[model samples]
Target: MHALDYFNARLEATISPMDYVKAKQMSPEKYFLIDVRNGPTHVRSVTIKDANVIPEQELQSRLNEIPQDKEIIVYCWDVWCNTAAKVAKFLLEHGYKVKELTGGIAAWKEMNFPVTNSDQGNNIPDNCGC
Candidate 1:
């Protein structure tokens, strides 16, 4: 099967980029958007708001840190990145709810979804709704 087919199959046979976006809007706090990109690389791209910054290399030891009850949506910098896929598979193997963000952050940006920088001039206020 093609990689895309494999990804869709892993998504319980019905996953799409738009589905993830819709799920994000349903309950922002319900799902965990786990970013597996390295620190330096992630900083240079469009990062999602409140995404968990856990590098792929450290995920094996850090899996316990994530709440198993919540669904995990793994993502990386771009379509070429496989960190998200690997993380998703690991989470699945561990019996945790998991899904890989198709095309990762690049696709998120392409869809014109919200992106923020933690280091940027406080565009978002501490108490203000984002």
Candidate 2:
């Protein structure tokens, strides 16, 4: 495929921070936001509020927890992080509709979007003690 075609195709698998907000506003239930940061990073950094906490390393084991009906939107710490992309790709390969959050949580924070600090790691699901 041409470079432009490749770029366009790649864009389809990603969502911008602003567009994410709009999508959530339009239909909150249509998307399933997952924070793929590891336990340590997630505890120290702020994450998009209400995002399901599933560290990248734990994804395979937690795959069943992800809802198949909603479009998965995965995000990591920042633009430098590739955890989200890896997780998105895994989900796609496993037959799930997924998208990586462009620039990750850093871009979302740069956009001044709503976020919740996870000082105590409470964002993680009850079943996960980490």
Candidate 3:
């Protein structure tokens, strides 16, 4: 089965940042990144490469915009946030293959992964903590 069918709604399996990094390095063509934070928060925070800003609330209507055949990684602000989880649940319900980006953007930067501001894709933020 495809990655989408395995996650999002069904909760059968999920992926982590380490796995994501591995994918980024090995299979960029097979993965898709999603930033589920609200637009304003996304604008104010760091973002990952290839991640699209699709707030959790808007996911229902925008499901088609996400590819069903690729591994999707979703993330929000941090541990206290559930936006990413919610988006994952919604995707699971809608039959989209999706996984929550572990640690959200917080974990991404913690691992020293690269990120960029929404306004301009330059100066990728230091995995600097929030």
Candidate 4:
């Protein structure tokens, strides 16, 4: 494939943080967001509002909990983290339409996007340390 086509194909399967927000706003039920970070890190950090917390290690067993009807959007701690990619690939192999969240929660937080557990007592660390 040509370089542009290769990159375009790759980009077609991912969603940026802002675009996710817009899509969610436009059609809340069209997408199912999953946070694939480990249990410990996820507990310590605030997650995107309404995103299902499914640790990557437990995903295969919890596959039934994910809705096949909706597009699956997966994210991990940050863009550098590959857990979301692994989960996305797994979901795709099982016939679910999947898109990875570019930059994950790190980018969401960086953009100041809203998250669950945002109470004053909630301590979202600067780094996930995953």
Candidate 3 residue lDDT tens string, 1-130 = 7878656544434566788888788877887788777644435456776678666656677787899988778888887777787887777787777777767888888888788777532333333222
Better of 1 and 4 by TM-score: 4
Question: Rank by TM-score, descending?
Answer: 2, 4, 3, 1
Alpha carbon lDDT of residue 54, candidate 3? 65
Q: Model 2 segments beyond 4 Å from truth?
A: 39-45, 119-130
> What's model 4's lDDT at 40?
51
Clashing pairs in 1: none
Q: Candidate 4's C-alpha lDDT?
A: 0.82
Write down the lDDT of every candidate, Cα atoms only.
0.69, 0.81, 0.71, 0.82
- Candidate 4 residue-wise lDDT, 53-101, digit = tens: 7777767888999998999999987877888888888899999999999
lDDT of 2: 0.81
**Which residue pairs clash within candidate 4?**
none
Better of 1 and 3 by TM-score: 3
Candidate 1 per-residue C-alpha lDDT over 1-130 given as tens digits, one digit per residue, 9 for 90 to 100:
9999886676672235689778778977778777677545425345777777666766787777799778888887776777677777778889988877877778878888777775532222222110
Identify the runs in model 4 with alpha carbons over 4 angstroms from their true place: 39-43, 118-130
Q: At residue 18, what lDDT does model 3 achieve?
A: 83
